[model samples]
Target chain A: MKESFSQSMDWLHTWAGLLFGWLLFAIFFTGTLSVFDQEITRWMQPELHRVTPAPLDLDAASRTLNQLAPHADRWVITLPYDRKPVGAIGWQHDGLSTLKAIDSRTGTVIPRRETRGGDFFFRFHYQLLLDQPGIWIVGVSAMAMLAVLVTGIVIHHRIFKDFFTFRPSASFHRSWLDAHNVTGVLVFPFHVMITFTGLVIFWAIYMPAGIQTRYEGDMNAFWAEAELFFEREPANQPAPLVSLADLEREARNHWKDGQTRSIVVEHPGDRHALVHMYRRSDDRLSLDSGRVTFDGAGGALRAVWLNENPAYLTQSVLTGLHFVRFGGSPMRWLYFGMGLAASAMIATGLVLWVVKRQGRHAGADAVGYRLVEGLNVAAVAGLLVATATFFWANRLLLPDLEARDLWELRIFFAAWSLCLGHALLHEFLRDGASLKIWTTQLVLAALLFGLLPILNAFTTESHLFVTLPQGQWHLAAVDLTTLMGGLVLGWTAWRLHHPVRTSARSCHTQPVSSSSGSIGSS
Target chain B: MSLAAFLLSYGGLFALCLAMPKHYRAMCGANALPPRPVLLMTRIAGWLILGLSFVASVDAVGWAFGPVQWVGYLAMSGLVLVFGLPYSPRLVLLLGILAFLAVPLTIILI
Candidate 1:
């Protein structure tokens, strides 16, 4: 209970990361997958999923919006990407919310896309579902992550010397220690910066003391500028507004090849109805800040809003850096590799905790080591199985079921909890706690994954090989990734206890030597 | 790649090449680290990376200066690698500095 600063940090790091590590890992793991979320969303819903994306019919969408909500000030539409075919449009009305999707051709509002089922897992990563406090918790966790990154770099004395030193079979703790230190050091900068920026990105919302102190305690004044929602204007004149059709053209001309995503109308029906449009460009990886504003009643054009060199607002710059919308896929790849490294670092940290505690409590039964080991099983191994089960649940669940969204999310947590239960029970039954749990999860995961495509064949009648040209590659990618993960888990499980089988002679001698036989830093 | 781009990319790569060897001697080759020739090459690489960053900053403006944006990542990466030397607390500090500037630097073009 009484430890040094480093020791307290050790406590903080262990419990903080351990308690939420699964959540964080699930968050992070899902988040990384969310980098391709829209794609995955498409994959999950085979009914509307696409392999070859349909062309964006801006005119049709435009016409439909004008016809459907002519009285409303602004209309927002999300263009079809490589994932989904249906276009989503939402217009604001007084106290009411008007959200509908239109078919590309008929301009009809179809049923809102399948409920936010699978998306719950993705959203839960950051949102935590606990409301405002949840944000603070995640924000604090992110800052702690930054601290962990820094302290990790500080503690690992010979980091650069072993830039790529991941020697397996070294010793349970030794090998895991090496992996933790190496990966942590290699990506320390990224880990720290990303975590810091991620926290800062939502700084005002999370820690608003500064804004409250400076801006007369008015959060609106702060949000007004942050989101660029200009102060609402008074409506003295009764002037008929000009069509948003013109502003759309102007945005198209400026950001040629990019389509408009939204037109936010502030103070509709006023003398000055302000139309703000969000448009994307073709030159780069991410959507640009090429937004145009208009005085709707006067039909006058306001200045276009492009993101200045990120230096304008500290928050803007930090948001851009952490979210990685800057240079495109390569930087994303760079960040992603670092993220995976962080994941490895965390995994190794868990193993190190187990292996180190294993010795101090070497009596055939040590509660602390066993507890840590159980956590390792559930958090590390069980979380992975849950992730795969999510995909399996997607394939098995009916798209139109009334409670489909709730059902999908329930399966994810249910599977996760089941894996947790297995972790608790498996270690008690088998001599090699890690190996047995891993093998069991591996086999289960593999069986679930390998059978997914066949289940899809049986359930939906949608086959990946045939769906390729139909913009359904998203489904194929998920199925393929699941199968691959299954194989990896199965392989790791097999390797865990293989030595004991081949040479049972030294079973007594191998006394938990090192590396706990979990998957490598690879 | 532009001069800035080339320097950043190559500088970081070179530093990584040296860094890995120096850190994990048993598992890897004796990268020209700490040795005369390798140290000299690393110093030169460091200088070049810095020089390119300087060039990039000069050529750059509000944010999207072509050279600065192009070369910035390499310079940052190389900087991370070099400063992340063995037993040096400076590596941690340098990363802190980078974290401070990460917003300004990474979002060059915003």
Candidate 2:
């Protein structure tokens, strides 16, 4: 009975992993890149090259905001942090909002070329290129991943014994299995935490039954009561606004960490206008809950909201764990590396599904096998090539072209579709085309990533040489990471092309035929 | 500094894995497992090194932020060990030793 249960779990694990593996890989890949989102944003916008020391001039910032958005009903200023060195001002007029980067030193708008930058990848990770339904799809896939993890653990009874056992010199299928097992085991805690926290992050959307039952499906009322904050109704009586600099100073003085993250002025031209200053939360692992509000006309302190209930705090910490927003560069890099490992885990699992089947079928002309193999290449290598193409499009596209951001996104999809088409065509034309396609796509991705530094040097004023000496580590790191990614991909391609051939009699030899029989019989 | 600690932890884990019979024989070109005392010692030392690395991480980024950072370090270290073990055991061992030595040096220097 126990053996049968384990076999059932093995079946559950295999199907769950294979079904959502591609979507999970895409999510993991983009989510990993999102760790360096701000840095990517910076690299994309080279016009914001000069570093401006902080203690940002709010007086100048307010002046620029007033000039740029005089008729807007509300204005928001996002103060610069280490990653984002330029303050950003956002305004809403007639229900339309616009955001622009500002040089804190000169208080002038930085003419950054229009690019969605890192936000594209961050949003893409959660939304998956679709609109509302993409989120739910991602949520479902995440739940499937949770199942795979649990069942995978159940099936692999020798989890600890094989924790450090990675045999690359073993048979091809054995090596892939070992790689998948080791990656999955080593970061088991992280995988479970990340997936669980990821689900929790979208709890309001995914599990709305509680709110629906309690609040009669009135999300606004639930949020208002849960948040315990009141928004004042706007008075149409016209009045001149008080100096934003004074209100900012007042807000800073109230918080222990005197650093304000953003300032929001609502109904700026009315007597009931209110200004809110949000405190920075990077000093702690929890999300920012510090907010101070003032009457806009007199700059009088009105409300101070700093504390939250335990439930809210738990949610925030979970969000922080998934986001890694509170930590500095080293922490972010660590998250990025873990994310890549998780991606590799998913990729290997997908490949293992195909490889394990290949050995079972041997010489059979199975359409299902061909389809899965083609998809394995398209989902893994194809997605990578698509991402590199996105970066390339960012560099090569004309900066001032109309609807430039949309064009860049279009280019990304177009390239991705072409890759999928190529995979399908190759699979139909020739048997066992996946290996060839994988090698070719990997080499292509390597070239694109490897040449990105050169492209940046030619296209922009600030390249690695300039940014490195100027202490612009964010920009320099992007280039250095790209170069390293290229080298690694190139090496992987080379290794795949020329696999080592030791004698079949290794110390830990397990006959490939017997292994395939066991798998096939199961 | 945290990176150095991370490397040290990975090195320690790799050494401990090398002491395992299956991996040891596969990589070391040996027929017999290391002595029981050696395996026990490596296991204990491995846990100690990992614990020390955690302390180093906490030192770098306080108690509040340390665990998350440690999670990342553990993941990366595991990946490095997985990729490095089969192809270049010697280099992996050499780097592991250097990392083990650097832990104390990092503590003193930084």
Candidate 3:
């Protein structure tokens, strides 16, 4: 009660930021990578890299689905898009469902590697690859992020005065603070919008009181109203289904040349079969591109659901904002840059915590200080290595190995655990110095990322040399971006190797005094 | 048109940064703030160009997406200016000037 509001906010900012900063970094980093998820998936699947632009082979795809599951209850086909020029078909037979990737140009199944592809990063961004618990944890971290952003804004009183300020020539602690402030303020709008929308995207799960009260905990009912979704029981009477291409053409016409992203033939063999066509979200800011439903048996129009309700539109717009599904490649790049800035802001804040205390704790080696240092090294540098390792695993694993995707995930965690172990070992072997751990892991990450193009060249024909000349930007971007990432990491390690001059006086003069760590300092 | 919008945003942010006395000092190598009229002109022009960028972005896309893009461009340009200021102040200023020049060049091409 005695502390001023700003001081109280500072305390909250420091502690909350430290506690959840690592998790937030992972979320933001992966979320940034997820912006180019499709492109990354394209890079990972060599089978799709050399795909020729061709019209959707719906007849062939449909025939394949029928052959695969003749008595299936429903059939679904996802059409090829610019980012991923491959079609996927799935059907449910009895209680089992089968899905396969097909070359849309050839209408033949391609045995693509069993990898989660870029969806791994997207899923990890939100759920950490865990199920419900991961979602809840992410929700909590998001809330913490919101609080940290608010408190950060509150504590930094000279927001406008330091609007364009970044002093890289300053001392380590000072420069780190400047980096954090610069990133935080420069893209403040994006930071706020992204976090708020991230929460909004999962508002139902995070705050289910509305569904619990209004829909009696039936999520399906809530979504039915929220999304204007409808369903009907399958009539057992057998009926011939209409052509998918015809329905798709109709939907495209109805949407005025809008591209159909996916089509689902529900109860394909039943009299009441419904064909639903989803319009792509490429041209619109809202992810809800509106759906057209037809009577599958006769191909007659049944329902065209274009969300016009203000609340639903707003929700979809917010979700769209979070998903970054609109505005093409330029917009995706902008999101990617801003997302990296956000991650950088958190990274600087995490490093600043340790640097601010380094002066007093140089030889003290407090358990809390060491713990923070080790965790910071692993969470920051180690995680980078883990990401690079994931990419490496994708290439090195045997192509036809069973459950190969899970192996990639295991390799990622294993590499991350090793980094943590190395950091902890350093903590015990050599107290008050983590430079070796930082340098080693960073160099490893740098090598992994930098040599990725080379690894790709060896593993597949879709390397930079091949993709760059062929105008295959989706595949080329992955190689170029990773090379750039490696260069940046290597440069960072070089900077750490040759740090700026630091003196005892300069350390003492840092704004974040040792007393600030004590909540009662002010 | 989107390219023009981003350029205008970059130039506008540079002008805004130049309006600040400290940054002006950093860029212009002046120990003191600029005259009142010069500061006023820079600030007004900065905001005006930023407003133009909003218009250009809206023209490039549409109402639904224009404003979002404008914000993104502003943030990105601000970042370039902030990070570039400490190391390559002259290059940053030149880049801003190039952006302003290219806006007209892009318009000509269109």
Candidate 4:
């Protein structure tokens, strides 16, 4: 009975991993990149790369907004913080709202490139650029990931016996499987924590039955009650507003070291205007919990909202864990490393699925087999090519091009789709075990990433040579990481092109045939 | 302190690997497993050091972020061992010794 149970779990693990593995790879890869979204954004915008972080000047920002839109109703001031040292001001007038970057030291508006920046990777991580539908798709993929992880653990019979087992010099299938197991097992706790937290991040949207039943689907009213949100309608009587610095000081006093991330003035220049100061999430394990509301005209503290509900706080903490918003740089690097390992785990699993069938299913007539083979290449190597192209597009495209951000997105998708075509063509032209498709895509990615610093040197002043000497590690880190990534890719491509043969007879003691047989029989 | 925690976790994991017959044979160039008492000693030392790592992490950061950092440190140390054991067994063992030695050095220096 126990043997049968293990066999069934093996079948389930193989199928579920095969079905959603590609999507999960893309999700995990982009999510890994999203860990350093702010750094990437800094690297993309050359103008703000070296901005001296000065104290936020609210008065100058107010003057700029007043000059731009004297009759504006609402104004927002985004304070400068560590990762992004540029403040921004937006004002609404005549049904149009405009936002511009500002050097907080001078409070003068700066014209920066309008690329989507690292936010593209972040948004794509969860939404796949498909909005609501993409959320559902990613939700399903996360569920599949949970199931695959559980079943994988169950099928790994010698979990403790082979806890530190990894043989990179074994047969192709054996080595890939070992790589998959080592990465998955060594970081098993992180995988489980990250995946489970990811599921709960969108819990309200994914499982909204309670809210629908209790609150009749009135999300605003539900949030108002749950969050203890303070609100007031605009009093149209015109009145001069108090200094925002005073309100920020009051908020700091109340929270005792909490830094304000942004300030929003509702109905500015009115008697009933309200100013809301939100605390940054960088110092806490919960996102957007501490906020102070004030009377805009008098700078009187109206309300302080801190999350106190146990369930809500748990959800927030879980979300924070997945987002890695707290704990500074050491924690960020830890998450970045684990995130890459998770991506590698998924990529190796996908490759193992194809490699296990390589002996019997490497012909054009085996359409389904050939299809998976082609997709394995496209999903793994193709995504890297697309990511490299995205970075290159940031530097290659004209800074002032119309709809520049959308053009970057288009080029990214175009490169990915072209990679898929290349994979399919490469599959049709060969019969078995020819990895020219992988080699070609990886080589292209290597060039794009390895030469990014050179491209930056030609296009902007924030190249590695300049940034490294100036102590701009944020910009230099991107260039150096990409260069290292290029070297790894180039080495991988070389290995793929020049296949190494090692006999599986010397130390092959495990039951590799049993696992493959389960996949075949099922 | 996080570095100390990581080294402790690495040293602890290395001890656990040494307790296992396969890794011991591979890493120590031994044809047979050690005596029963030696294996038990190494296993106990592994768990004990790992527990100290948790304490060190909590002492450095507060209770809120400490355990989180501890988990990350453990995973990182395990990854280093997983790769290091197969590629460079001698270097991995040497690092494990240095990791254990650093604990007292840190306590005295800091």
Candidate 5:
């Protein structure tokens, strides 16, 4: 029998997705969470909880940079934005590199900050637990996913027909298939663009011939030219540097009316040293931005290269688009929504796999079945539990513990591995009460996320309720999210545990309950 | 320690799978064959190669070390050969080339 195009596509989509569903799920979940990365970073640092206007002393900050960076080859200063409490950002480089905040009025050192809240998750999302290679592996998986998407579209003849179809009460497989198709069709453009761009971002590793052949094997040389936005300047000879305040003034002139946001001193205190002040303005090259560079000793106006210029504007635009830096709150919300949809798509695809395979119970007790069952439990419930464990670890970890970053990462992977093992063992035992098992994890998630804020308040004085009204929203946002997530999970658990079938079954069998034991499959 | 532990767990799973009794032919479904043990040598080697590929990613991300520069590539190519004449060798080769070409070009452009 000849399969119709739509049928062919359905077949292609189902099998291809089922083949790598777990990987796709991980990528989508992590990528979606990456949308709120900054907020997470804000929440984790309990010490820097104030939201008040903490602008820095520019004069003193300038003086400090001048004094410390007598021979700094180059430097860039990033002014705090609306998210941070203070414009207290300061930078200086001599033999040492320091990023300190100043008392907006007094210019005192705010020192290096602690707390790895959202940033930890954001970074960990893309770059798995295993260091640099982990990121590449994740990237590879993402690329594979892009292939899956394209192939899926090619095979699906009735894309429009399935666009809005969602039948929740249908058979499990039918429901999962419908939900997956809906996510795939509605955000088709977003899914394609995101995956394509993601692959393009890592093209150099996947295809280096253009560089190796063109640059004649000098990767560094290629990078030197390629990384024009943040040019690496050679160190300069020792010499007195000029005023940073002056550079700021010079940079503002290019903007016509805007303000200065950063300062870069190249080869500070050397014969070849130059100082650059970046004006904060919206231009064609916002990513390739800011201005003002000058000879240090003589104070001659040099070329302005704060990530700007017509030739490299396209890359600047691409970078801006990739990072979503050009837009404000609305764009971030859009990205968040898209991310959630992407995750839902992957989850539905996995569910569809189980539903389809269940119909073919030709060898239900076979090795393949056992393996798939274990994977289903592990990837679905176990992954969530592992992720929750990460938050739990963060809460329990001692603040002053040495190598806390590594320890935090260790907890994530260790917990994940443990879950995978547990899933395999439980699946081997013919566990039929999946709903019961899943409900337990959801309840745990609800409790931990629900109590997180109260715990934060007890453990630290810088609680979000105190921080939010003042303008510091990071901590408040994290707490609010946790509490909300807890409520959602608690509800989900209740629903799963007290499912409609269970209620109906119990009512029907109530009269014979005393005689019958183990009414439902255990 | 991590490497050794991974090997042991993978090895044990391989062994356990192999020892599972294949249902008697009379009891088996008409089309179903008895479950055969997934060979220890094959699973162990496959996993080891996978681990190496993961390590190769380290070199790629860490130093952008010259392409095909990691020790894992040696194990990786060997492992890929294991299915020994996969039905679609040409396609796999093409994909491999594409992946190799794509990663570096993007890095340069980026």
Candidate 6:
């Protein structure tokens, strides 16, 4: 009975991991990149490169907004911070919203090129380029991942004993397993935390029972009550508005930490106008720190919400952990590294499934095996190629092209689809020569990433060498990371082409063990 | 300073791992495993070193952010150790020893 349980768990782990592995890989990869979303955005928008950090002048910003969008109902100004040194202003006119980067010193709108930048990856990870249904798909995949992790632990009895074991010199299947297990175990806690917290971050969307029960299916009412302390109703009365500078001063005096992250003004030209000053929570591990609001016309303190309740605080902390927006450079880099490791773990597991199956099946089953092999290559290596192409598109495409942002996204999907086609062609033509496909794709990625720094240098005035000495760490870090990525991918490609002789020998001669067989057959 | 603490923690863990019968043979290129006493002593020292690393990390970041940073360090250390062990055992051991030695230097400098 015990043996049967383990066997069943083994089966469950294998299929659970295999079925959603590709989607999980996409989520993990894009999610990892989203850690540096702002940095990537800054890199993509080169016109914002010249902008420097300075004290926000609300009067000047207001003047700019008035000149650009006088008739807008609402205006939001996001002040420059340490990571992003350029202010951004967004406004809604005729129910249409538009946002643009602003020079913090002059409060002039910086004419930057249109690109989705890191937000593409950020949104794609959750939304998968679709709308509401995409989120449910990602959530389902995450749930499958949770099941896989749990069942994996159950079947692998020697978790601790083999904790530090990674025998790259062992047989092919063994080495892949070792890589998977080592990466998984090394950051096991992170994986669990990330997965669980990711689910919680979308709790309201995934499980609407609480809100449905409490508010009788009225989400707006639920949100209004939940945020009752800061709720405001539009009076729709006509009156002249007070200066935002005065409201900011008043808000600064009210909050203990006087740093303001952003300023929001609603009904800008009306009597019931509201002004909100949100405190920066970058230094602390919380999502919503607090905000102070005032009557826009009279400039009187209206409401203050500090998020002191235990439930709210807990939710903020969980969101903070998932977002890592509170951390500085070192913390962000750490998160990035751990995320990469987690991605590698998923990639290796997916590859291991294909490899283990290939060993058991022979010539008659080779076609099906080859098809899986092609998909494994495309999903793993092809996605990376697509990401590289996205960066390349940002650099290569003309800034003034019509619908430029849409074109960039189109290029990304086109490149990715081409990769899928290439993989299929290779499978049919060469019987799924995985090594050849892997080497080619990796080398292509290496070249694409390796040249990004040079491209940035030629395309823009600021590159790694220039930015590093100028104390522009964010831009420099992006270039440095891309270069390192190129080097790593190049090395991996070289190694794949010419694997160590000892390991290759063992891979061919080693007998198929019972334990290895169970992973595939069970 | 946090980097140094990470190295020290990782070095200590790597040492304890090397003292394991399987890893010891793999590293030392020897047929016989190290005696039980050696393994026990290495394990104890490893725990102590890791505990000290935790303290160092706490001192660097405040109490509120310290534990979170420590977990990041642990994951990073594990990553370094895992990638290093398979490709080049000798290099990993040498780097681990160097990191262990540099902990005191880092402490003095900081």
Which one is best on DockQ? Answer: 2
Q: Write the per-residue lDDT of candidate 6 for residues A226-315, one digit (tens) a residue.
A: 554444556767777788887888788766864888998887767778888898887778777878888878888888877787887788
Clashes of 4: 0
Candidate 2: clashing pairs of residues: none
DockQ of each: 0.06, 0.68, 0.54, 0.56, 0.01, 0.50
Candidate 3, CAPRI quality class derived from DockQ = medium
Candidate 3 — which residues are off by over 4 angstroms?
Answer: A1-3, A71-74, A92-98, A234-239, A362-365, A501-522, B30-33
Query: Which tens-of-lDDT digit does each residue in A1-522 have in candidate 4?
Result: 988999889998998998899999999889989999989987888877757788788877877776776567789999988887888898887677777889786678899888778889999999899999999899999999999999989887666678877766555677678779988887888889888899898877889988899999877777777776767777789887788877888888766567888988888888998888888887778875678889888887788877778888888888988999899878988898888889989989988877777657533447787678788889989999999999999998998999898899999999999999889876766643336677889899998889888888999998877988888888888999899999989988886665444423323234343232322211
Per-residue accuracy of model 2 over A268-341 as CA lDDT, tens digit each = 86788889888888777666557888898787788887747788878878887888878788788878887888
RMSD of each: 8.6, 3.2, 4.0, 3.5, 19.1, 3.4
Give per-residue CA lDDT, model 5, range A161-270, as digits (tens).
Answer: 43323433333444456567667765666677667666655566666888888998776776556543333455434666666666666666777666666666666567
Report the first chain's TM-score for all candidates: 0.80, 0.93, 0.92, 0.91, 0.79, 0.92
Ranking by lDDT: 3, 4, 2, 6, 1, 5
Error of 1 at A335 (Å): 3.8
Question: What is the number of backbone collisions in each predicted candidate, taken in the order shown?
Answer: 15, 0, 0, 0, 37, 0
**Residue ranges of candidate 4 with Cα displaced over 4 Å:** A1-4, A69-74, A91-98, A232-241, A267-272, A297-300, A362-365, A432-434, A499-522, B30-33
User: Can you give the lDDT of residue A212 in candidate 4?
Assistant: 93
How do the residues A68-148 of candidate 3 rate in per-residue lDDT, one tens digit apiece? 776788888989887768888988777776668887866688888878789899999999989889999999999999999
Error of 3 at A339 (Å): 0.6
Candidate 4 docking quality: incorrect, acceptable, medium or high? medium
Instruction: State how far residue A80 of model 5 sits from its true place (Å).
Output: 0.8
Worst 10 residues of 2 chain A by lDDT: A513-522
Q: lDDT for every model?
A: 0.58, 0.81, 0.84, 0.82, 0.55, 0.80
Consecutive 10-residue window with the lowest summed lDDT within model 5 chain A: A507-516
Which digits, one per residue and each the tens of the lDDT, describe model 1 over residues A323-430?
554454444445555665666677777667666655455445665556557667777777777777777777666657776766877887898899888777755555
* Candidate 1 chain B weakest lDDT stretch, 10 residues: B24-33
**How well does candidate 5 score on lDDT at residue B32?**
45
